[model samples]
Target: MSKKEVETTGHSWDGIEELNNPLPRWWLLVWYACILWGIAYTVAMPAWPGIKSATAGVLGWSTRAEVAEKIASFEEMNAAVNAELAAADVTMIKPGSDVHSYGVNMGAAVFRANCSQCHGSGAAGNFGYPNLLDNDWLWGGTIDEVAYTIQHGVRNETDEARYSEMPKFGADELLTDEEIDQAVAFAMSLSDPEGDGTNLVGGTYDVELAAAGAEVFEYNCASCHGEDGTGDIYQGAPDLTDAIWLYGGDHDTVYDTVFNARFGVMPAWGQRLTQAEVNAAALYVHQLGGGQ
Candidate 1:
């Protein structure tokens, strides 16, 4: 419409007035360009919904194809290393070779992400969690056991997982700390039963307390750890009399043990990794020298 014929309000509220000017030539051209671009884009790209699907795009690009291509390239870059790992057993994935070290490092990363919460940074473990670094093991410390522990886990509630339960001493009110200390000291003493020196914590092993603790032990721990504290491998119980402690052998550590019960669990890795990867980790831990 022409400006001369256009109607406008002479009076305006808040000093604002309506204008009769048409849009600029460049502005109208840009607006039309945008409309054209929209039509072109709808045809050339996957923008609009359709009965079957959106447009395939001028380049025939798709999100699924893009993702698959990226993955293919990534796998291609790692092809040689993956091939080497697939061929090698867990035992062969040592720290020496760059290829083997890569596998070990990768396995360590996996362990840190999944296993470190309980097993600790160095796999040192807590009161209940078994120390991976130590020679002492509830189940056999072979490559099979290590891999099994990683894959099926410990007390993991999985069908094939290893399961065990340490007796709740203080919870059951079976033994007082003083009495438990006596038992702990006695157990520690048995580590070197015929040694010349007296045990550091021998004061705790009073005859009365030992008697009380022994009664408590017989009542609870004996069923799994055994009357002689030799432990039952079938039940995955560690020998209490051994100097090797999964947590620690200190008085405070033992007190913590009796005061608060310990129940450690490992996660099942069978679903997370292939059999080859599981075997690799098993051999890695086993060769760390605690292997049976």
Candidate 2:
């Protein structure tokens, strides 16, 4: 049979005649290749959706399976290091060993990613955060204590957590500014009293101000700070009598503390990391310094 001619609308513009056009040879070939490639790809790799599943393909490739395999390989590579960490006691992971250094590096990663929000890069906490580098710890600084704290955070509102509350000085009306200042001065005096050797050497303390501050301490602070200005650690209170200060020992530092109570918290790591990682982190923190 003869082929019927294709028809076009009888219209012409700009001296151009409109004609019915057949599929272009190049375009048809490209479209054909795409269809073939799609079929081949579906057969070789996972593709095509079903009611409840997808075609497995000849290679059986899957994103989830690939991820799992990668993770498995990584775990295998670190198997020996993890075993060593698990076998050793926390105290043994101090500053001198290879394991100690590795643990420190790992712990630093964890601290920066998770703990750095509150505990500054140097572990020097802010007004509400406790300085981890310092010896003064609310819960405890032992390797086990550090580990426990990481596992069960503070005020975590969970079963396994270290919890405590510091009175809001100004909010609770616990002490007036003048009274707080006096307490602050006394707290500072515990470490360096005016006219004392440390104060004289520093030349920062005011004699008359300290004398007035002493009275404030006697009335408002003596109860918790103690008569000799020695803080009770059992109460989660810092020892002002010591020269070392977690925040700062300067006049302004002391004054800030008195005006506003400081409440610090540590999140529990137990939920976030494997037991092995938590143990390593604890040892790492303990060895940072001032660990008892």
- Give the clash count for each candidate: 0, 8
TM-score of 1: 0.58
Error of 1 at 257 (Å): 2.7
lDDT of each: 0.68, 0.72
Residue 73 in model 2: shift from native, Å?
A: 2.4
After superposition on all CA atoms, how large is the RMSD of candidate 2? 6.6
TM-score, cand. 2: 0.62
Question: Please, what are the lDDT tens digits per residue for candidate 2 over residues 1-292?
Answer: 9998777667789887677788899999999999999999999998999999999999888999999999899889888887887677776676778787777777877777777787777777775577778777766777877777788887766887776565667667887777676666556666764346244124255555677878777776667667787766545666676655666677776566666666656666777787667776776677678658
Residue 280 local lDDT, model 2: 68
Task: List pairs with backbone clashes in candidate 2.
Answer: 150-268, 150-269, 151-268, 151-269, 151-270, 152-268, 153-267, 153-268
Tell me the tens digit of each residue's lDDT in model 1 across 1-292. 7555655657677888776667799999999999999998877877877799886878676899989999899769877786777566554455588766766666775667767787788877776676778777777776656767777987777899988776677778767766676666555554446543233433133344454466656775678778888887768877776666666666567667766667777778887876546655665566556647
- For residue 258, give model 2's deviation from the true position in Å: 2.2
| Minimal lDDT window, size 10, model 1 | 196-205
